[model samples]
Target: MKVYGVVAAFWLSLASATILQNGQVRPNDYPSTAISAISSYNSSWHTYSPGSPELSYKGRWDHKYISWWSAPGLKFGFQADQVAISFGKYTSDGVLVAYRLGGQDWMLTNVTANSTHLFVTPSTTGYNLTTPTNVTQTLELRVTNWAYGVQIQCVHISGGAAKLVKIPDYTRTMELIGDSLSAGQYATLEGISSYSWGLLYGLGNVEFSITAYPGICLHEGRCYSNLHGQTAQWLKIPDTSGRALDIYGSDLADIPNWDFAAHPAADITVINIGTNDNNTANNVTATGYYNSYIQLINEIHTRWPQSQIIVISLWSGFSQVGNTWQQGAGFLDEIQNVVKYFNNGSLNGRGECSSCFVYYFNTTGILEHSDIGPLYHPTDVGHVKLASHLMQYIKLTFGWILEQTGPEVQHDTLYWNDEADY
Candidate 1:
């Protein structure tokens, strides 16, 4: 597939127009002689660009890098025992990435500009991944934190691109839009702890893209940085760009306009925002929330008009005082109006509302009173609960059934341990 080149903006719209029929896992592509070498013993290395269709992007492609913690990064199969990749040519130093063969514990690597790294071999120190009997092995790469982004310049396979294999059987694409809760703030491997990741990891077949940023309000204002925040209606690049420039010292610019058509239009798009807007600090009026949300939904519909939109009311770790947990700010009530206004025709005095295929799920009391964590976000355990609840809702609402059970043991626990310092 000609995955790159923005010259023809036509394909961009088409990608967003393509939606998966139903949620389904990719069929496993195990050859009859699974363990047999697919190439001659004399292996020659070959390089392929990030847009090479040979790569299986389990994560969202910003058209340059696999971003956000929802699906974290990319994964692909290689016939060689070893591989090398330039994860970042434009990214600055000190960006950490974790990668491992399927069924292996994550191994960490730090990146600098245009750095090339080889897969850790079995005999190498600190290498704990299993050496499968099969020659073709799949490598899963993910960013270690949300404060930064990882870009793949090119990948070098030992044999050739001909040996590259798809991850197989993935049926649907979902774009997750939210604030810190979806960003996995305060949890280990932040994005991985989000409800979006929870749903994707639990369901197993859906490809997910996260549009979450910590501290962002749906109505927009100062959030993660002093510059601007990603609002429900005006988001193109995620708000993480602020963190990228401030904290990581990366040479990057906020993408002027995110290419909506870079990936297939989402089959399902979930919106979990409003915490920052209705909080006592922001106290953004209901009128502002209603108009902003109406515009956001209308914009999403225009891009992926056929996709289903799921809007979830906000949740939080309420502040505790005098042995009493304060009730939440009632953001869900306001969010419900956002949903109601869409289906009932735009009631917002703002111009208009596009026709929306939307559903509003009340997540007011999703977490146990005990599941809230610091920063008023869900704890690792609470994320599990939120993901589970949403998955059930999707299954019943869309008639989506799973072909396999997940998340494997690796996915269940934190990718980081106390011994390792990120």
Candidate 2:
């Protein structure tokens, strides 16, 4: 967890114009006459940066209207941590290109749009220019046919050089404990995207480490006789050499003894285990899974006395585990009750009070398939949906502004290398 302070320094450019008010997009700022100019506030011409565009199961083209303005040079002085473009292709070859600042015609850049029906964040390059230059910035859709049009949900801008007071690094350090889903497998065709990993990767700042096994069920009785290998594999501490140990029952004895002194204590801990426990046909008991979950929660809370614990119920498509219950009704209902119970319990000294919160978000197995990659994990689209949901919850509970969910846009080109991990 390295933290650094950043400052946004501005340089004078050659172009000049009356400086606009200090804020993000203001509705009327866009040109109403340009083709079919779509602004954020369709009702009121005030808000500029849109919250989020509605994602599609299939394909739909949407675009936002942008205007050309002059401030003197080719740069509009703003810094963001990450940027995302909510757009879709009309035909086969519709690519969103970065229009060079302060230019009339659209100049093409090498940013490739993702095939998934979601907004994709382009790889961050380095600083836009050695020094800031006053220029007009906007996005352009480059399609094979001039008449063909695509739809853009919105443009997300965040994490740039901090202006005014020096801004510190804000990527939350999170600890995830669960099964294959939490491990971030099978989200995309190539398994390149998982909901967890996508959240970590998509956000401008956030570091994550996963501790999960592939086939282990959350219920204690479901543990097979050969649980030793699976348990050892699940807790194989990254970058650590350890001995193989058998894990019987739901008691994660090995994790408690592991040294966490050097590792940055997790700020957020997510527990997503229960898909396998609900493998019964038609009959399932909420109380049964709840009791085991209570024990697991108690154990996790006992160990990480200060970390926040969040429990997630499995997404739709998973079947109920039992002979009498077939659908997800009984299982999810019970799980929600358990979460509500545990959430209240945190305030009663079970976990970190005032700071801990538990929530259950509905996820879909199909959303994972939308990734361009071959794995079944959540695609970038799926991650965005999850992020939107999580961000709302976190904002309401923690009373913190979701920096990425605001009205603002700044053009940036960050040079990123695929070989390195940030």
Candidate 3:
């Protein structure tokens, strides 16, 4: 892959078409459009150039939900009767295109890949863009696959040219690190419009990243031999075997590591692990788990010194295969003890990181009552519940105000009265 410095001309070449601004067609000489890695965007995982503008490498671990480009002044152009998007090297079975039109809520549309250069006319699901023409809108796009990648070359409008504007940088950034639950494995099983908790939590102005894999565990040599040693593995790009591939080859062999310096550090990092660690087949002891947990936290602190790390408690639902409810409780207890140990300065050596915290959200009510998907994974409703609980926790812990309201909770009368198993 080619590496380019942060030069002005690099960003300018992306805008190949003219845009309308302030009721006038701006000259075609402006920069193509601002294309930068924001939230979950990572440049190392894919390849890009002028010829194959948005091509991505094909491999097992290359799957990711990368944010391609953000156009800020979309509201400036004439009301588009139709919008056309072009993609290159499209390999995914299907890709989800999410965008916010005008001031309305974010909408999801799925585009099926047909060939190398695929053109798609997405359905305007939520807000009608045909009636409104003179409003400013911000557009963001993300790929849905966690193992395959896609490239978005450009977007066009039917009525008038789209005015490319600067992408807005949020005041705070948050990162969620965990396994399938945090990755929204089955949130969309019910429907394509379903959203993950990470996306819902980042609804408004908060930039966020979801670094997770479905079957990943906290320790190595489990479920999949390709798993990494700790949760920190997701911070880097993975190879075919799910191992962290060296970011720079040959010349940088001595410094073979992901250049985290290129990515923005998190202000609040929430970790939800241990579900896979509790596997009976893994035979991991309580002491071993605690040591691994603390090591992961230390690594996170080293990466983002200013980050407030929040270690989430294991969601109280299912234990690993062959484990009973009592064993699951014990696992949760061990995790709680580990959190206390770190908070009390017993593990950190240095005094406790006052900003660090632990939060518990009981999943028993949601999962045991069938308010979830197959394998007891949280469905759309369950994700919303998790997000709502986390939002309240964030408000109380950090005193941060909600920038936007999340999706409305869908309560099922049948399961509303079910007793929580945990």
The C-alpha RMSD in Å for every predicted model, in order, reads 12.4, 20.5, 14.1
Error of 3 at 368 (Å): 5.0
Q: Arrange candidates, best lDDT first.
A: 1, 3, 2
If scored against the real structure, what TM-score would every candidate get?
0.73, 0.42, 0.63
Candidate 1 stretches with Cα past 4 Å from truth are 1-44, 62-71, 103-107, 120-136, 159-162, 166-169, 224-226, 232-235, 238-240, 243-254, 280-283, 319-326, 345-356, 404-422
Candidates ranked by TM-score, best first? 1, 3, 2
Cα lDDT tens digits for candidate 2, 87-173: 433211232232332222223322222222211112322235333222213222322111122334344443333121212334466
Q: What is the RMSD of candidate 1?
A: 12.4
Which candidate has the top score in TM-score?
1
Clash totals in order: 6, 57, 9
* Index of the highest-lDDT prediction: 1
Error of 2 at 146 (Å): 43
Worst 10 residues of 1 by lDDT: 1-10
Each model's lDDT comes to 0.60, 0.36, 0.45
Q: Could you tell which candidate, 1 or 2, scores higher by TM-score?
A: 1
Q: lDDT value for candidate 1?
A: 0.60
Model 3, runs deviating above 4 Å: 1-83, 103-108, 112-135, 156-161, 189-203, 238-258, 316-327, 345-368, 372-374, 405-422
Stretches > 4 Å off in candidate 2: 1-171, 189-192, 221-257, 281-288, 318-330, 344-356, 362-380, 400-422
- Pairs that collide in candidate 3 are 12-32, 14-32, 15-32, 63-146, 63-147, 63-148, 75-135, 75-136, 75-137
